[model samples]
Target: MPKLKTRKAAKKRYKTIGGKRFIRRKAFKGHLLEKKSPKQKKNLAKPVIVSKQDTKAIRIMLVC
Candidate 1:
């Protein structure tokens, strides 16, 4: 049987730590910053874990 290949895009954007997948947060470094609150800006800097429902699909894509 052929080896399963990992998704290149998923590999670049997602990271796995202790078998958990973390995705980079959006809208923090981009435009429209003035409309957002200070706490929102701070929170956006942190990475978000992939939801449990989606974790299985991401794991397959990540091949981790």
Candidate 2:
């Protein structure tokens, strides 16, 4: 069997923590920051874990 290749984009955007959970950067904080409120911007700064529904797909993409 051929080895599975990790999705480069997913590998770059997502990270594994403690070899169990996947962490990713919050969205909507990359551009047009002037329009978003201070609180909203601050909240977006934190990283979030992948949802249960999406975790499976992400894990496949990451080859984990």
Candidate 3:
């Protein structure tokens, strides 16, 4: 049997919390802020949980 290697790219993008929930940065926060509203920019600053369907695949990538 062999151990699985952690995907560095995934490691940098996703974070595991309490071994159940996965947290990640919200998209569309970079650049082009001049046209975006204050509320939209504010919301993008927060981290969000990964979607249910995607969590399964993300978990595999985060495996230790």
Candidate 4:
């Protein structure tokens, strides 16, 4: 059988603490910071868990 390859792009974008769950950075944090409030910016700084619906696909891409 051929070796399964991990998707490099998915590797860079997500991190799994353990098991199948993946942590990813929140969006809207990259730009337009000036207009964003302090609290909102702070909240956006944290990473969030990927939803259950998306977890399956990500697991396949990550080859977990």
Best by lDDT: 4
TM-scores of all models? Answer: 0.70, 0.90, 0.86, 0.88
Q: Candidate 1 lDDT, tens digit per residue, 1-64?
A: 9877999987887888776755655555577889989898888877787788888888888777
Instruction: Give a tens-digit lDDT track for model 4, residues 1-64.
Output: 9978999999999999778789999999999999999999999999999999999999999998
Off by over 4 Å in 3: none
The lDDT for every candidate, in the order shown, is 0.78, 0.92, 0.90, 0.94
Q: Root-mean-square deviation of each candidate, in angstroms?
A: 2.3, 1.0, 1.3, 1.2
The whole-model C-alpha lDDT of candidate 2 against the native structure comes to 0.92
Q: How close is candidate 3 to the true structure, as a TM-score?
A: 0.86
lDDT of 3 by residue, 1-64 (tens): 8998888999999988888889999989889899999999999999999888999888889784
Better of 1 and 3 by lDDT: 3
Worst 10 residues of 3 by lDDT: 55-64
Ranking by lDDT: 4, 2, 3, 1
Ranked candidates (TM-score, high to low): 2, 4, 3, 1
**Regions more than 4 Å wrong, model 4:** none
lDDT measured at residue 38 in model 4 versus the true structure, 0 to 100: 100
The candidate maximizing TM-score is 2
Clash pairs, candidate 2, are: none
Worst 10 residues of 2 by lDDT: 49-58
